[model samples]
Target: MKLKLIFLLTASILAFTGCNNFETLNTDPARSSETQPEFLLGNAEKRASDLLYDTYFNGRIGMELSQYWMGTDKTSDGRFLFTNDGLWSGMYAGPLMDLQEIQNYYDRHPEETNPNILAVSEILKSWIFHILTDVYVDIPYTQALKGDVIPQPVFDKGKDVYSALLVSLKKQIDVLSNPGTMAIRGDVVANGSAAQWVRIANALRMRIAMRMADAQPAEAKAIIEDAVKNTMVSVAQDAFFPYNVATVTNRFPYNDVDRPLVEFAVTSTLVTYLQSVNDPRLPIFARPDETNGKYIGKVYGTEANAPTMIGLSKPGVMAYSGSAKGYMITYAEVAFLKAEAAARGMAVGSASAEELYKEAVTASMTQWGVTDAKVVATYLEGVPYKGGTWKNVIGTQKWLALYMQGIQSWMERLRLDPKKPNGEVLFIPPASGSLDPEVTDVPKRLKYPSSSRAANAINSEQAAKSIGGDTQATKNWWDTL
Candidate 1:
């Protein structure tokens, strides 16, 4: 099933590439062209969701790095044995290309173009690029997606990329805020709701702004303040793709029948922390140990030498099901961002940091379907903000709330401890003897893929030189402590 899905996605890419001159192809009787902006938008949406959810989130590499789960193998991701090839390819060849095609379609038919479709395309483009830049730091931005026009695109500085993305997101919001006929036919995520799109755009801006908190404080403050005033105000406004079991393209990839039953185990770092705080979200996050009928989590990076897995907890069915929704950005995340802003003396709505923090936690609980009032109330009472160490407190809870959305969680961990002497944050523990001796700590950024080296050698070499070196230890502009 997974292979079939991959074939279909690959075929879609071929179809788009084969009809590069879509306008001319549209007039030819023998060639089929995707001239409709709605179709292009739909395809872009699905491709983006698949890359973000299936390739990144569901892949569990980020989860292992973030210490949310532990692998059972010796050379597993818990020991930092992973690569960014899947992510690099998915972002560049799949969604990024499709989004660029949407822009190309808009450029060809300016008068006939739907404003909402163009706006959504811009939002998604920013979304995919944001993920790309966050993970790899420096990436092709200005000259990216130009195909033959600029086959060897130079990598832009991470900060410059963020600046450009912020400008793009703001433009999308301005276009979406006004009253117009939103093209909803191909929008699987928000159903073409202009209001929802605006909310998502603002939320995305907030996320990018927070990513710049350490490196670009003034800009981050301004962008975050504006986002707080305009972004998703409630859980109902969260941007997410609802996966359906019947839709092969939209189904969660981890739900495949051939997948291993014990592919991942709840990490001791996560379960122990939750248990210490008596977090009600634990049972919802992981199944009880089969042997002791209690929650048991394995130590990170020690899965290979760990004792029998008869009692270890695995991720629950809902956590890895085909019907699980893929979140682009959520109100809870926005709330937490606002909380952090408030803690930093930035005005984010009428609520104080404590108020926003509690609200964020509740919103996350609600999103996970944990509606028991007592359970929520108890958890809240147990984990109230202690006033000091705001970064650690908020960062820890945010990490917990961002389960399954692994990449974002890892990014947050980075932001929280941008320049730690040891690359460990609140929820993610320090790397011990699990990693290779040469790897001193958690990686700051991914090396450029081998494909980039072979295909775009000159530009790739320039990028590597500009960003220190093409190694995991090289820190991006935003990694400044």
Candidate 2:
């Protein structure tokens, strides 16, 4: 009891006397610290790439919605069930947060921060927001990623988000054109090449411009003209984001066990269209059925009468492999944008619509390993471009080129072919028996995730109401087709 009293009296005296250095003494010297902004670059890139090509976002949600691949044993996604809201939650909390930190680092350490790195970071952030706004329509934009300062960010209108992104992209494009003293480090996407990022930024501008062309023609025309005048990604300079080897820790999501290709089969919509067009890429895009050694696709959303896994065709060997790269902004996509711009009577340099269309097709063929001149020429001959049917031609061809890129293809589809007054869509709808009566056609936009609603109820409710309800049928601001 005497020792306890002594200890208590000493501790009380120390607490009062040594409180000046308490924080320093209590701080753990071995605790992890924040990395330099450069180190965060690759992490942000990988996270965005994962969101683009991962099993949940791309495989289940994107590919299913775009009708590129359909579930074998599972059909909910193909039937327009977007239960996994990781596309929203994961992005805002994961990559977007990383990017925001990068910007914050620059803001805090302006003298130390490289302007080029900041430019790249802004470009990537814009890219991510572009995806988000397109998918969710009205998402947390202006007030997003503020951490505790604004725990619940108000959602920005989709049009306003697009406009802001375009302005930001234009500013960053100038910065990348004239980079800073420090060379970019840990750049897994472009090998620290500021030039490559310029192309990507311009491509993004073109994509956004095209998406908004129908709704905001004057603004879209200005952006499109500016991007086309600038240097765009060429066929030789395609941005195919790399994936690691076929390891358990690092592999393409389609080949990884978590969301293996075995769970999905080629959709009949894709197979039938490819076959009708005599597309040589059919074999390259889909593997022959294991049962009959024939390329047979499963009808999308055929829950009741879906074929067995071995009875249907899976993704091709190259595509299903672990090393297959994710498409960031392909040359083919850029060429298609140029072609569309030209076809729309917009001034886009010397190339005519037909010439650009052929180039775009060739670029896509080359991307999928079809490089033979004769084969490409033959394929082009099969689908000649017509000015009268330019929209259908470009839309169909772009969809085909964007075979595995689910979200991008879906966006293009929504933009190119708007839902008719009678609720008709140009793209294939899910099988009649498997569709939720509430959603009979292809989804226009993904509903805000339930988690988002739960966390930011008032903001989510307001955004949903502003964008014509939080449902798959609601069209985004850009999808005025």
Highest lDDT against the true fold, candidate: 2
List model 2 lDDT by residue over 1-481, tens digit each. 9999999999999988779888778778887366678778888888788778888789888888888888876778888766678788889888889888988877877887788888888898999999999988998888999967998889998889998999999999998888856798878888999988888888889998989899998888889998877655566777766887656655665674455456789888888878877999999989888789988888877774444577789878777777888777888998999999999989998989999999999999988899999999998988888877788788788988888888998888778762221233435677744355567867888888888899899999999899888878888877765
lDDT (Cα, 0-100) at 22 in candidate 2: 88
TM-score of model 1 relative to the true fold? 0.88
- In candidate 2, residue 75 scores what lDDT? 78
Residue 53, model 1, lDDT = 67
Over 4 Å off, model 1: 1-32, 55-58, 256-260, 303-309, 418-438
Q: Candidates' TM-scores?
A: 0.88, 0.91
Give me candidate 2's TM-score against the actual structure: 0.91
lDDT of each: 0.78, 0.83
Error of 1 at 9 (Å): 48
